[model samples]
Every structure is written in C-alpha cells, then in structure tokens.
Target: MTSATHRSAAEIGRTATGPRPLPPLGSQSSATELSHVDTTLSNGLRVVAVRKATVPLVEVRVWIPFAGEDKLHPATAEVLAETLLTGTARRDRVEIDAELALIGGDLGTGVDPERLYVTGSALSSGLPTLLDVLGDVFTGAAYTDAEVGRERERLIERIAVSRTQPRTIAREALQKQRYGDHPATREVPEASDVEVVTPERVRALHAASVLPRGSVLVIVGDIDPQTVPGDLERALGGWASDRSAPRLPALPELTGGNVLLVPRAGAVQSQIRLSAQTVPRTDPRYAAVQLANLAYGGYFSSRLVENIREDKGYTYGAHSGFEFTDQNATVNVDADTANEVTAAALLETRYELGRLGLVPPTGEEVESVRQYAIGSLLTSTSSQSGLAGQVMALASTGLGVEWLQEHPARVAAVTEEEVAQAALDFFAPKRFTGVVVGDADLLAPKLTALGDVTVGEQD
Candidate 1:
C-alpha cells in the first residue's frame, strides 16, 4: 500500500496566508411570480391554487377555524381530528387507506386552539381521487364508536408522555403566565377531559365546527390554476352550511411585567421563555423588524446565542422569533440551561435583549441579517410542499402568493436606520415578560435578586 500524507486540521483551514478571507456573498435573485388563482366557491370556502410544476406531485392544505368556548371543546376537537378519516359512509378505514395508497398519497389531521388543519400529498395524476377522498371525509366522516374509543386511548397516552416533557411544561407555564384565562392558552387538552369524550360528542362537535364558510384551501403542484375552482366545487359542494366557522376570541394584549419563577422540584435543568408584543407581517415596518429580530436571537448567529451559548456556555441553544395568532403577533425568546447556571443564563439573556436596542446593529450586521431573511424565504418556497404551506399561511392571514413573491424586495429595501429604530421600538428589555421553570428552591434567591422575578405556584 502507498503511504498517505495529509495536512493537519489547522493547516488545511488556512491558505498560504495566515488566514483566508471568505468570498463576498452573491446578489440574490428575485423569486419568479407564481401563476395562481384565488376565488371563493359556492360553498363559501376560499380556494387558492398555484402552478409550480417542479415535480409530478400535488400538495394540499385546508385550514378551518375550529374555536369553541366549551370547557370540553379542546378534548372533543382533538378526538375528532384523530378519527376524522377513520371511516366515511361510503368507505371504511381500511378501504380509505387502500385507496390513498393506490394513489401514492397520505393524509393527516391536527387541531390547535385556532384551527383544524388537514394536510396531504399525492401523485399529480391522482389529484381527482385525492380530492374525492378528502370531500368524502369532510362531509360524511362517521366517527364510529369503535374508532373513537381506540384513538381516544392512544391520544391520552400521548398526552401523558408529552405533559412530562420539559419543553411542554415550559410552554404550558408560559402560555398561562402571558394569557391568563384566554381560550388560546388551551393548546393541549387535559387527559381527564379526553377520557370523557364519547363518540356522540365528537360527532356533534364535528357537525357544529367543521363548516367551510370562513376556511381556506390551498393547492400547489403541476395543476392548472384556472380549473382548480371547478374541481373543488365538484368535490366539496356538499360541505356547505349557512353559518360561518367561528373565529377565536381576541387575545388580550401582552404588556411588560414581572417574570414568574415556576418550581419543578428535583429537576436538574430549567427553561427560560421570554415574550414581548410586536407588529404583524402586514405592518409597513415589519421588514425592518424582521431583520432586527434575526440579529437579536432569531438565528443561530444571533447576539443572544453568541452571549449565552457560544461565549458563556450557559445553554446549548437560544432563539427568538415571532408568534402570530390571527392579526396579532408577539416576539418570544427561549433557552434551556442547567439548574446551576439558570440564573446566570437569565442575566445574560436580559443583557443581550437590552443591548440589542441600545447598541443596535451596525450596517454590516444589518446586511448579514437581511441576506439571511431573504435567503430563508427563497429556500422555503422553492418546493411544492413548501409553496403550499406558505400559501396556506398567507391565505389564512388574507394574503396570497403575490405577497410572498414581493417579500425579497421589501427586505432588501430596509435600511440600517430603520433596523435600529425597530430594535429600539421592539427589542427593549423592559418590554418583555416571561417564565423560568426549575427547582425553585435552588433558583429562587438568585433569580429574585436579578429583579422583576417572583416565585409563583405551578398548577
């Protein structure tokens, strides 16, 4: 065998010079305008279809507002989504699966506080079969007693496992800390409540909540946009009702307040979740705010991550991003740290938040974040599924594919001064409030000493 020679890691990383300079980033190209049609069918469902013939596949997304005020609505809705396609009057569970498999398709449903979502994909040649199967489920799902009972037991087990997870606990604590008693806070249903849900109740809830008037349907693939409305009318014409889907009640605006320290005894790790109110995507200044958010903690190379994770080694990761509910939006920051360094992590986290507004990002930093934002948007919409998801999200907010096509220009036009102003307006530390969950006995004294922190009882 011939002897092999290789350079050391450090030597390989550098050129003949002491260090190498990275090549300048290339100018980003604008996204092509997608051919699309947005229209309302006779049944009152808004359908948005886009033609992106990248592959021989079709992606579908349906969003229906499914909010309710009943104490058991969450559990009922959860069970309803799980058993939605288990059977229909024309087809049983096995037959439905067989039909979908023949078309290289799969479908699934999920319900949150805001909406019920049905998402699926199929071969382009099988588009009609896919839509027919969907229409059958939407209009005539049986929610049979046997299927309901089986899924209910499975869902209860899943909930039990998820409730014990640290992230889930932290999320629940954060929602309660911010929203108090709003319906939007009820993301996960109670296991006890799910145990009580019967087939009859699920059927009744489906009948009352699964209307299409205020809902949106998005389809993207190798299909003609002009003819999609006719196909949808033929498929979903029976899914009609005079009453529109019920919208969730408006959430109370979040304001700065004391951070709550929630005790989790014997836990070796802690979660820090911070929140502050901010503008939605429709706001004229949103482009600047988006860049500012990326520089602060929205990306891996953000200030918060550099301070807490890279420099101080207090957490593995840290992030900040916007959470939109209907027309309102808020920025949230999260990090997980060991119990010993939880207080230190919180201090550094707050320090970065304050610094983002006071010091602000320079021109170099603004350009870096702007490039990242535009690049992410382009990459996310380059696929059929991604395009469908983006369109669905925009349609839910009363926007369309045109908004996505024009977004890169908006980000490119944002100025460094505008980014600084957005940082000052939105990223100030005093504008935030949140929760830290850990072994309160160990974390209490240090966190309370940091100011604006109070120990609270966990439910």
Candidate 2:
C-alpha cells in the first residue's frame, strides 16, 4: 500500500500522480450588449423591446404600480386581478380567451402589495392583436358582479387554505413583526375581509390606480425594435390617465431585534424566517454582497446548507437570499425542520451566521461562488424568455437590460476582501430579526433554553 503525502489546501484538486485535467473552459466573454429599444410613452407607460429573431414568439410584461392607502386594497386588488380578464367591454371572457387562442397567445395577472403584473406571450405575427387585447382590457375591463363574485369566492378559498401553510404563517408573522401595521404588512389580506370586497369597491380601486401612467411594458422575441414604439403607440396611445398611480406607504426601516416565535398547535415541523436589511443592487458594494450571500446560503452548496443539512441532518433544505426593490433590498434566511430539532437547527444557523462573520470566506471559496454568480447571470439571460424575464424584473426597479449585461463584469471583478467585508457587515447574526413558527409546546422549552422566549399565538 502506498503512503500519501501531506499537501497544502491549494495543492488540492491536483496530485503528483493524478488524473489529467479536463477540457479547458472557453475564453469567450458574455458581456455583450443586448440589442433593444427603451422608451416611455406620453401616457407614462415605459416600453422596452428586445429583438430576438431566434423564435416565432414574443414575451410581453406590463407592470403597473397600483399601490393605495386603503386598508382593504389588497383584498380588493386581488379580486380585481382575478376578474380583470373575466370580461371587458368589447370582449367577454370567452371572446378574450378565444381571441388569444387564435393568436397562440395568453395573458395572466397577479398582484403583490407593490405592483400589478400582466405577463403574456404571443406568436410574433400576432403582436398587434396581443397589444390590442391588452389595450382593450386597460381601457374597458368591466368588473361585472357575477365575474367579480366568482373570483372573490375563489380568492377567499385560496387564502383560507394558504393561511394554514407553515411558510405563510411564518411570513405573515415576520412581516407584521418587521413593519407593524404598515400596508406592506398586509400583502395577503384576511379572507373575511376579502369576502366583504364588493364589485363597486374593486371598480373604485381600479379607477384610482389601474391607469396607464406609472407602468412599463416589455416585449421580447422576433420583434423589430425600431417600430415597436410606433406599434405600441397605435395600440396603447388611447389608454391614458393624468393622475399618478398611488404609491405604497413607504416601508419602514427594518429594526433588528429579538426572535419572534409564533405558535402552532400539533405541528411536527418548524419554520425559521430571518430578515436583515441590506443594500440595493445599484449600490457599488452589491457585487460582493451578492457573492457573500451565495456563499452563506443563497444556493444549495452554501454554508447554511453545509452546516444544517449536510452535517447536522436537521432539515432537508435551507437557504438565504435577497429580495430587491426599487428603494431597498433585504436578506432573508429560511429553514424548516422537525419540531423536535427546531431549536437545534436554529442554534446551528446562528452559529453559522456568527462563524461566517468571524472567519470570512476564503479566497478559494469566494472565487468558486463568484464563478457561480457570473455563470448564473449568463444562463438566466441566454434564452428569449430568460432575457425577457430578467428585463421585466429589473424594470420594476427602474433598471434596464443594460444592467443585466453589465452585471457579469461586476461579479467577475469582486475580490475576496470585498466578499469578506460584505459577509462581516451583513451575515452577522445580530444584524437579523426573524420569526420561528412551530408547535409551541414542542418548541418553547428548547428555544427558551437557547434565549429569551416569547410564546404567542398568531396567524
């Protein structure tokens, strides 16, 4: 038997008598500019058209900031999203679906506390028809009582079931804990409140916030960039409003404090949801921060997973990530484990958080995650829908495809020191405030042994 020789860590992935190196990576770069057009209409609808001649279809994204001050707007807005396409003045639900089908197109609507999103796709030849249909809805959606009633019933039913989900329960507690009674705290309104939302209320909310002003439209795939503005003008020029779309009451700065524990009876698992305020993508430190997040738990191979799932067997999966917005961004960590192991899992999680700050990431680790970050950016923008999706998401933050194209350069340029600093600043356990939702009887004693305890019941 041969004896092995000692080697430095850098000497790893290689050996004196080792397997030959695999094929070399290609030297080509992916920082090329995306060919596209960007313009905002006189009515305040921003249009971005990317010409991709590869496929016969076009992906469209339209975003309207329909924020309002009403305590019941979320419930009413949800109903509006569900019923908006049910019927319009010119076309009933059947006619709308049939028209879209004829053009091999479809559209869907959804709302968060912040904005209303309309996403659709159509055969390239049917761009005009798709736009016309969208324009029709924008100008003439009729929230008929029957359609609104049915949608409201369906929405309330979903909300009823969703409230029972562990993740939902934890998220609600975290949002409330973080923001108090701010409108942002109430993303998914109460089912009872939703049941009370009438067609007239929805119509009023629509009239106040569903205008073309303060909206963006994105089209990608086999479209002529030069003429998209003209076509958009022809279709959407008539859809105009002079009033500004209402804005969300500004989100309060998240103040990090103690862990919020929400009780659930007879549950066998626990959810840990953590939030730490962080910088936005536009910040110069963002690249390093992004890499730091990936190394910690933004991906499967991150430190959080390495400690909890791989080493401890406490949970099947764990993750840490960021949710970016126009004005702010936040770091979030999530884990779910058996009720019995909940306290231990959270202890290990906090241990990892502190350890990452103390030790920082090694140069090798930073390089590996940096490569992953850059690779992910390239992959996400490689296809037509992928590019369209990235652009649409960025548009919400007032960013363009140029930001996506330029991101690879930033990721590649991030140094180990930068990632380490970002880690120390953002990954420290004290920087976070969070909630642990689980069977209180099973969790309270163990978690109380770990720190100050707050036993409570909340939904």
Candidate 3:
C-alpha cells in the first residue's frame, strides 16, 4: 500500500484535512438569488412568490400554525389535520384526487401542534389549475357530515394498525414519557377522539387557525415574481387574515434522573430511543450542535455506527439527531439490537459520547464532519423545489435569505471546542430514558446494571 493509505489508517478519526474551497457561483452552481415578493390581498390573504427560471415545475405550500400548539388534547390536532383531505364542496374525494392525477400533480397536507402545511407540486404549465384546485379545497371546503364520518373511521383504522408495529409503538410511548402531560406528548388520536372531530369543529378550526395572512405561499420553478404574485392573489383572494398569533403555552422542561423503558415480550430484537431537550432553531448553537450531531451518530460513518455495526455488529446502524423547532428542541439517539447485545450496545454508545466530549476528536475528524455536512447542503439546494423549501422555512421563522446563504460559512466556522461542548451537553447516558421493545424478561436483567431501568409493557 501507498504511504497515503498508511497515514489515513493511523490518523485519529477526529481531524479535517484542510479547509474546503468555496464552490463557484452563477448558473454553473446553486448561487442564484432566492428572489421573492410578498403582498396581501384586499381580503387579508398573504401572498409570496419566488422565481426560479430553471426547472419546469412549481410548488405551492400553505401553512397553518395550529395543530401542535393548541391547549386541546395531544391527538386532536393530528386528527383534524387528517380530516381535511377527505372531501370538499366542489369535489368529492375521488373527484378531487382525479383532478390532481390528470395533471400529474400531487396534493398533500400535514399538521403538527405548531404548524399545518398543505402543499402541492406540478409542472409549470399546470400552475393555474393546481392553484385553483388547492384554493377550492382549502378555502371553499364543505366539510360535510358524511365525509367527516368517513375520515373518522379512517383515522381509527390507522391507530389500530400502529399498535402492531414495534417501532411505531416505541415512538409513541417515548413521546408520552418524554413530554409528560404536555400537549405535544401525545401521538395520533384514537377512534373515540375522532368521533368528536365533527365537521363543525374542523370548520371552526379552519377559520380560527388557518389564517392566510400569517400563511406563506411559495411558487418555485419557471415563474416570474411580478406575474406569479397576482395569480396567487386571484386564487386565494377569499382567504382571511389574522393579526393575532396562536397562543401556545411554554413546553415544560424535562425533569430529572429517570430511565423509561417499554418492554415487548417475545420480541426478537429491541428498538431503543433515548432523548432529551436540546437547542432550538434560532439558537446560535444550532449550527455547532448540528455538526456535532453529525459526528456522534447522525451520519452513516458516525461513532455509534463504527462501534455498533463495525466493531461489534450489534445492529444495522445507530444514529442520533437534533430536531429543532420554533420553541423546543429534541436530541435523540436510536438503535436496534438483539436482546443479548442491547445492553452492550448502549454501553458502547455512552463510551463514544464520553470520547467525543471528554477527549475531543482530532482536527481531521472535525473537518470530515464539516465537509460532509456542507456538501450535503449544497446538493440538497440544487432544485427549484429545494430552494423554495428553504425560503418557506426562512419566511416562517423570520430568518433572512442571507442566513441560508451563509450556512456553509457558519458550519465551517464551528471549532473543535464547540463540537466537544455540544457533545458534553447532549450525551448523558445516565440521564437517558431508555425504551426497549423486546423480550423484556430476558433483557431486563442485562440492562439494569447499566443504570436505573424502568420496565413496562408495550401496550
């Protein structure tokens, strides 16, 4: 082998080779402006448009900040979100789907406590029809009694199916234990909750929460800013504005020193999730934490992957992430291993945390993470749809376009010290609430020596 191969093998995995040269700008690269125009119609609808002359497609996204924030029960918001797509005044469910199909376009909507987004994408040539269809579905929906009943049944079926999936059950249990009685803690609404999701309730929610004035409209593709804004205004002219922001209570911080475990009897493998509150999107530590996460277990080549999969073949892959939100943050590390190795895998993961924090990775390891992150960011923002997604997030959070553009520099600016500090902040296995979906009788004794393991059935 060459001297280069020898050096690579000897190098500690914590150092970067050298600073990366910036990529070229202009049409040769994704250096174009995130040009957009913002206006409100006479009826209080807010309209924003971004022009991307390269792709032959357009994306329209409508956001509602209601599902995850309200003081209502945890599952109610998600049930309401699922109910909206059932049918409407102008078209039944089949007809609505057929219309979107004809243009090769797609219609979709999602809800979290903090926001709801109804989005669609289509060829640029089909923008007018797509926008018209969305306007009809969102603003002019009938919310009939028959449709509401049908949707309620469907949501019930979904909840029933989720119980059989080990991974799904584990996640739901984790959210409940982690968030406690907080509104965001709950998973999907059951059939009984859906029974109360009346047409009147959905309609009331539409009026009170789905404010077009607070909404963001994104048009990306071969569209002109000057022309696109007018079309959006015409389409959403009837949408009402709301000056008042949705009232969301502060999320309670996680309390101390307990490990939560959900055990599934007779299961061959254990699915584990350990999490804690971390940093928010607007926090300056966001970028630093992001890079640090990439090195820990966020990436395919992260420390957990090397230890769990390479060094000891415990599972396919182990990873961690920092999910940033408007108000709260979550840093979770997830992995799945057989009952016998579950305890060992968890111990190894803890060791990695200590090594990354207490023994700070070399400069090379840090640079590798930086390069991988920035490179991924560059590729993801190459399309018109991608650019529009970035813009929508910025507009919603009131972050500037420059923030997106400067992401690479910020990531590159992260020092080894910051990464070590982030590691120290996030990785405390002793504080983790562990969920193990496996043959609990066999796994409990093995895991108890590691920490205080609370075992409960998956039901």
Candidate 4:
C-alpha cells in the first residue's frame, strides 16, 4: 500500500511539474512579403505576374471595366461577356469544349454591377497553348445570331427558375426598392427586354466596352514576367487602346424609405432585406465602416447572429455586407426566418443599428475585428487564385496595386470612435429601405404594427 501510494504521488507530481511553452504572443506580424506586380503597360492594362516555381498551374484573369454600369448597348456587354466562350472565330463551341476538356481546363466569364471579368486556369505545361486559345476567344469572338438566341433561351430559363427561389426573388425585390430606377437595381431583365436583345447589340457593346486602355491582365503561378508580358502583348496588342467610351454618370440620389413586399401564395418563411446609403469605395471611412459592420452583423459571432439566431432562434443566419462600387455605396442586411418572427427580427436589426449610432465598439473589439480582417486578407494572398482575385478587384475599382499593399495598415489605424461615426452615417433608419418576400396575407397583420406596408405580386 505504501509503495502504490508513493507511485501515485510521483505520477501526480510528474503530471503537474515543469514549465510549459507559451503560445506566440499576439497575432501574426503584418505580412511584409507581398507579390511583386509591375504596372508597366501604358494602355491602362494593369499587368500582374507572380513567378512561383512551386506549382505547375497558372491562373490568368482579364478584368475589363465594362459591366452593367457602363450600359453601352442595352444588355449586349453582359451577353457578350457570358457567351464569348461559346464560339470564337477559330473554334466552335464543341471544338473549344473538347480541347479544354482534354487538358482539364475551363473558360468562364461573368459580369457584376461594376465590372466584367474573364478568367481561365490551366496547367503550366499548357500555358503557351492556353494563351493562344484565350487570345482568340477574347479578341475574335463572333456573336452569331444563333448563339445569341440560344443564350437568350438559357437566360430566360435561368430567370424563370430563379424567380421561384425565395432568396432570389427577395434580393431582386430589395434592390428595386432600395435603388428605385437606378440601372444597378435591375438584377434580372424582364422577358420583354430579354427578347429584344439581339446579336447586333452584343457586337456593338463589344466594340465600345472592351477597350484596351481600361483593361487589366493578372497572371499568377509558374510563369516568368518578361516572357509572359511580351507574349501577351503580341497576342493581344492588336486590340486598339482607343479611348472611345465616356465616363460613367453620377450615381442617382438615395431614394428614401419605400418598402416592397412581393406576395407569395404560401411562404413558410420570409426573406427580409434592409439597405441604406454608404460611403463610396475611395472614401477614407471605408475600412472603419468595415470594422464597424463586423461588430454589428458581418461574421458568425456578430451581434445579429448571436441575438437573432443563437438566442432567439429566429433565423438560420442574419448578416450584413457593404457594397462598394464606382458610382454608389450601400450597406445591406439580410435575414430569412419564420414568418411569425419577421417583424421581431427586423425590429431587432433596427435596434442593433440604433445602438451602433448611440454607442461604439470597444477598442479591444475593434482591434480584434481589424486583425481578423487583415489576417484573412493575408491568407487570401497566399494562394495564386486569391492573388489573381485581388488584382482583379483593384483593376475593377481603378485602384493601383499599392492599394492592397497598404490595406493592413489602413485597417489597423481605424479607431473605435471613427467606426461608430461611420455606423451612424450609414445605418440611418430614415434612409433604410425594407423588402420582404413571403405570403403577404399571412404577414400583413403581423408586420402592420411596424409601419405602413405595401404589397406587390408577380404575374
């Protein structure tokens, strides 16, 4: 018994004894080693190249400053951006698909409200071949009438199906209510508009929107800048750097509080969206507002999520985001929850907004969110795909490469008081526009206590 007791005491001492190593104090130091981007092209094509010898893959992205905001030939720019890959002068749809499939590569393009992006990824061994193919597709696309009609059908089908999704309907409705007649608010084209979109319009938009002077080329992974730039220039130099397009128009003024509720027949839940005017992308308060939004409802542990989801069990998720574009800026909050709790959830969201106006985040919380955002940004820069995305964002916004290099410091310098001020400026209830998609008949009585309500229905 004495022997066993001594052995146990020794074991306990061993378990509790000795010094433990401390964790790395504080967060990681700001990333000092960033990619070397040379913006040498004079025709406004911001070229970004990263020569990483480790991976045998390359990601090339061409971001053109042509999106819905440009609106040159109705919807032609967007249609061209979408269907360019369907056929080029040298390659038809089937042939192009077969070639890309054989090499396990993909061709894709998209249009947001502010910019058009064409992106493709392929193995480094196939870089030279892919470049030729990419050049042909970008510069030599033939927007045939057949292709236009086909893509129109596909788009119509997409719209028809998307309208059935509650989230999609809610988002479209919300934008219309928030922005009113602004072209940015037109998320989906009507059947009349879609039918009128012709091949001639698509060709006309291509001529005006895809100007070499306003484009940027970003290439990352196993590549040398010297050789790649020369080759790209040769392949794409034929593109005239003529400045033909006019400057984008001034953004429309914020259309004040108008609620739009699209009445669905029997919706079990309601999707609600609230938006208010915010500072533009170049605004000095951009980073400060970002930190404040994180504290409000931008993250998983944000106040809105903690209160509405964790405590109240009212929503699957509730979050907010800031949309910074060339013409306008806005902060948006979204939640989808049971119909019975819709008004409560909205009121709680308003309460959070009002609270931010009254009291700001603590210095500690502000710093934490700043650190979180910077860390995430750095982590994104670590990958070639993410690096290319960063370049594309800078190009789309007419920001220089140095903008990203200085982002961490900018975020770090934002003070708690500044964040509070940004919140008040952005989250004014009077400026907020509300939109709901659900059974209006069921939700009317429940939401009537909040304010005067107007309901709309789709044909």
Report the number of clashing residue pairs per model: 0, 0, 13, 0
**Cα error of candidate 4 at position 452, Å:** 6.6
- lDDT (C-alpha) at residue 47 in model 4: 77
Candidate with more favorable, higher TM-score: 3 or 4:
4
Per-residue C-alpha lDDT of model 1 across residues 21-137, encoded as one tens digit per residue: 768999987888899999999999999999999999999999999999999999999999999999999999999999999999999999999999999999989999999999999
> Quick one: ranking by TM-score, best first?
1, 2, 4, 3
Cα deviation of 162, candidate 3, in Å: 1.2
Arrange candidates by lDDT, descending.
1, 2, 4, 3
Name the 10 consecutive residues with the lowest summed lDDT in model 4.
66-75
Q: What is candidate 3's lDDT per residue for 226-283, written digit by digit as tens?
A: 7876787787666666453363456666543455567677888888787767777668
lDDT value for model 1: 0.94
The candidate maximizing lDDT is 1
Task: Report lDDT (Cα) of residue 153, candidate 2.
Answer: 88
Model 4 alpha-carbon drift over 4 Å, by segment: 1-26, 38-44, 51-54, 67-78, 98-104, 244-248, 253-258, 452-459
TM-score of each candidate structure, all chains considered together: 0.98, 0.93, 0.84, 0.85
Worst lDDT run of 10 residues, candidate 3, spans 23-32
Question: What lDDT does the true structure give each of the candidates?
Answer: 0.94, 0.86, 0.72, 0.74
Please give the lDDT score at residue 14 for candidate 2: 69
Give the distance in Å from residue 273's predicted Cα in candidate 3 to where it truly belongs: 0.9
> Which prediction has the highest TM-score against the true structure?
1
